[model samples]
Target: MLTNACAIIATAASAQIIAGRDASADDWPGMASLQTVLGHSLFHECGATMISPEWALTAAHCVEDARIETGGRAYQYARADDGSLVRFGVLSVAIGAADLRRRGAGTVFPLSAVIVHPAYKPEKPEAGNDIALLRLESPWEGPVALVDGLTVVPREDNLDGPPLVVAGYGRTEEDGPGEEAFSQTGRQLSAPKMRLQEGYVPFVETEACRQQIDSLVARYGLSDIYTDVAISPDSQICAGAGTTDSCQGDSGGPLVYRDYADPPVQVGIVSWGLGCGRPESPGIYTRVAAYADWISGVTGLQIAAPQP
Candidate 1:
């Protein structure tokens, strides 16, 4: 029953992007923007930091169907074919955009290996440990930092009160589609801090999300089951309202705690949401703290302090 239900929703809606535009070097707190290219066609994807230069974290769903390529090839296609070759691994990374309207000055690197969470189930559409790690072919020689103080379990305190900075190159409106082109670096956008329901972990209401699921199945014929969970291990955060939401292309970007004095820590990973910030539909995110051990184990890096 759960499997069948999951299949129903998996067919609904298109992939949503959580981040949009590129940030000037000063916009992103510690790390510069991250850009990924995959496949021979070089489809562009977004991601953020777990540790600078060592491990880059993002959504596993982004790479589930990707092919690996190089940055040069990817960019060439983007220039020639637009984003038609985006399915390949061609990608570049840049940091500190002097002009917010344009791209920035960060190094573009090829992805050496993509290690996704072992428990990630594409068919479930639940965002369960939906996290992934990108091993850069070379170290980043820019301003990057690790997201620290994340726990593996949900905290009892209210995580919604603080003002969160949600940055990505996702579309400004839902279902409107993102920029038809790709860039070496991404932009940083912010959302007003909405209330996070810590105790009330909402599940995907099959009935509510049915229309989306039905359409997706009809068009893509996918068989994954989707739920309206506020936030799950799958890294999806549900938000609904109007234009104030994450859209297609924001996947794997960071939902950050930029209010901190020392460094802005990545609290969640943008995965999926219910209709792009619709009313009553709070945005969901992959809780970064809950997977600290798993991330550390996979990357072989020391966990940084949370408040530092």
Candidate 2:
């Protein structure tokens, strides 16, 4: 399965990890797990990053249909084809959870509001504007360490120059049923890891990323529903190294620019990729830096524009 977002014709992407190592206990304090309850079980669906005590950042598609109303209330359910509200499950985020089964006190927070980018296209997530923010029902009272390295605004210049890190509780392997199966059934099969996983990938230059994706389309004789642009440098970041890349359960997760000496700065949100860990194809992420103004306007928290 493709581990990113959109499915390209017969090509596809899921929400998890492809090839990554198990994250140490203190690797990422702000790292979070986007989960949904099913009967007696809470399953990890996507990865998220806590940006503030009451807010988290994730990919729009990961929230299914949770949206903010015109009057600022959050509508918490997806609608059926006939326009009736459908409650699949309750969505929540878990912090300070190295192993999801052993969630610690004050680590989980129920979401009160969901704000998906207005221009987000569900059918074509790869086209960009794939970011979203979730408001917690109450301020996070988890361990202070969890909020120590909150994601911040990214640098405007040299996005491709930084060493990047991606962490999630998504699948460590990239094996799954195809996208056709997901369309038939409302959900994709997730072989998620119980423990968090982290990996590093190099940022691919925009033109090079586009050429690689185009080559994949031609090689597979595939047809794409969203072909306006395969990879937009202004809205997306492309990064991968050999087979070290994010996969199925990693969507909405942070792709941060990390330097050993300083706190990591989130640069992108995991969106989509042609296939997981394919050397020739790289993962595509929603460029967080590009949406700084929109995020600030929605959150009412001042975020400085990237400086040269």
> Residue 18 CA error for candidate 1 (Å)?
8.9
Predicted candidate 1 versus true structure: per-residue lDDT over 210-297, tens digit per residue:
3443454355444333333233333343333233445445566666655557455567676654455444444446667777788878
Q: Give the TM-score of candidate 2.
A: 0.82
RMSD to native, candidate 2 = 5.9
Lowest summed lDDT across 10 adjacent residues in model 1 is found at 191-200
Per-residue alpha-carbon lDDT of candidate 2 for residues 67-115, written as tens digits (9 for 90 to 100): 5555444444655869776766667787866666666667877788888
Instruction: Assess each prediction's global lDDT (C-alpha) against the native.
Output: 0.47, 0.68
Residue 196's lDDT within candidate 2 is 73
What's the TM-score of every candidate structure? 0.63, 0.82
Candidate topping TM-score: 2
Predicted structure with the largest lDDT when compared to the true one: 2
